[model samples]
Target: MTEHRHTNSSTGGTSPQLSQHKHEPSHRYSTGKECNASGSVTTPPRPSGIHQILCIPTGKIYIGSAVDLRARWGTHRWSLRRGTHHNFHLQHAWDKHGETNFEFSVLELVGTSDLLRTEQAWIDRTGCAARESGFNISNVAGSPGGIHAQEWKGFINPGGNEATIINLQKFCREHGLDFPSMHRLAMGKSKLKSYKGWTHRNSVRQREYIKTYDGFITPGGRPAGSITNLAAFCREHELDKTHMVAVAHGRICSHRGWTYATGKRKLAPRTYTGFINPGGQRMLITNLQAFCREHGLDIVHIHEIKSGQRKSHKGWTWREG
Candidate 1:
């Protein structure tokens, strides 16, 4: 018998030259139907401009905002690989279909350097799918509005960083409607957490502090009640109290929950704070005068003091006296 042995490459001088190129399947199978089916329906790249339609498969129309049209699509492609797609609506559609089923097209690109403002306009116009987390989509930062139809349609002229009050003067002037009473506006909206009007914010501890702190000194240096026991106190004092105002720090009472509803304990007096007023950098003396005119009340009392040290003081000193 003749013995024959084959030498391996590791032993030395190549036994047989190994192919460096990748070995593919010798017989190619034609899944040409799959490619053709996907190809027949795949949408083409979209151009930039106003009023473009993106034929994103059935139940997947995502109207979006973008600075550059092509760049946005490129980002979507990368997002697919990284699997960090932020838009859940779009992702679900993509998962169900694939790249062929989706297309991104441009909608009116308002030429402005301000990308955020541009996006905000689109969001407001189209009502983006992921609006809650999307850029420039608005929600209540503080306070509330949109209870009435008129208020809902009209733009709220935010007065300060904290939107505690609506600018009724602007709303009236813009809409050509008679300036509504502050009380009406206050009554229109539900008490919100942003204003400390919610039951959760009106903790017993907060009421106790309001009741006892510096003896309920009003912001105007007059003695006021801690809404907890003000009315009974007034009734017992027999001072002929008519109306009262509780001026809280912009930060404190600005909590949406801290409303007249929450502030008015059964024993507490009716109280008005800056939150109840149309807020802005400047307080509307005209509005305040109007409120006083509308309501038959003499004394507008305040009930917050700003001293590091708490001291007892006589209540209800007349400003003129």
Candidate 2:
């Protein structure tokens, strides 16, 4: 007895057509052309998921989740090649290493609903931002999935009603203040009292928390002098006061060859040294390095002459210190 079997009309044979399984949940393929037995073309699955740009030489990867991987990769490549990419470090690396040295890879398949969470998880698992090796500038992801919103309280205006609070970033944007500076103020890390009339609720406590730095050292590791007010010192030295404060607070280590330290040193009064010119005019200098810096002369060369290692420099003879 012969048995009759049903044939798929699309295939024109007693065989199942591949397109018949297109809607199947288990069917998955990348975006490309799929030829059917009927001479018709079926579109492959569009990849929408996590992607990465890996620097083959450095092994540093920039992970990103996109709805359309091809389109995103094109945009990224365009921006990187044009040197207009938002990620400064990534752009710099791309510029340093040519495009051929980098490899674009699809890391994983993800759905729209799971995009942010999956991306954040991948970033965390890779420790991309946690370490300085990667180009990621921010430790937190773009999506709110991993944010501890409950732990972060908005800054309240102390001058206004108790309930009157504002977003720190918004306030900074509106007033031309820096968000990180204001955030540090709110977190009790900055000694700033206020920013354009917006004061952090913790400003008072922060003011008390920060230890006062009253002394400064020159770039050459010599004691400059005691300075009660950094702003005044900066004004006198024509230096950036805010940068000096940051250095003093240890927020930054050094700036423009100057460093900040606490406690005053009781050193002997700086005796003025004289430089004898060819015409016999004596130039009195309280700080030799400072004078050399002001006159744009090399201090080491001057020191060598001062120590009797050399005869003279720039037609000037170093006298007694």
TM-score of each: 0.24, 0.33
Residue 214 shift from truth in candidate 1, angstroms: 56
Q: Indicate which candidate wins on lDDT.
A: 2
**CA lDDT, every model vs. true structure:** 0.32, 0.57
**After superposition, which runs of candidate 1 have C-alpha atoms over 4 Å from their true positions?**
1-55, 130-321
Worst 10 residues of 1 by lDDT: 1-10
Model number with the top TM-score: 2
Candidate 1, residues 1-321: lDDT per residue as tens digits? 000111121312121222111122111112122112234422222333221222233422344434454455566656644544543344545566665544334334444344344344444444433334222113221111223213322222211122232444444445443333332334443233112211222222222222322234433545544444333444454422223224132222312222232234323344333222222222223343355556442223322211212221123111210
Model 2 residue pairs with clashes: none
Tell me the RMSD of model 2 versus the true structure: 15.4
Clashes of 2: 0
Q: How much is the lDDT of residue 61 in candidate 1?
A: 37
Query: Which residue ranges in model 2 land beyond 4 Å of their true spot?
Result: 1-45, 143-321
Candidate 2 whole-model C-alpha lDDT, 0 to 1: 0.57
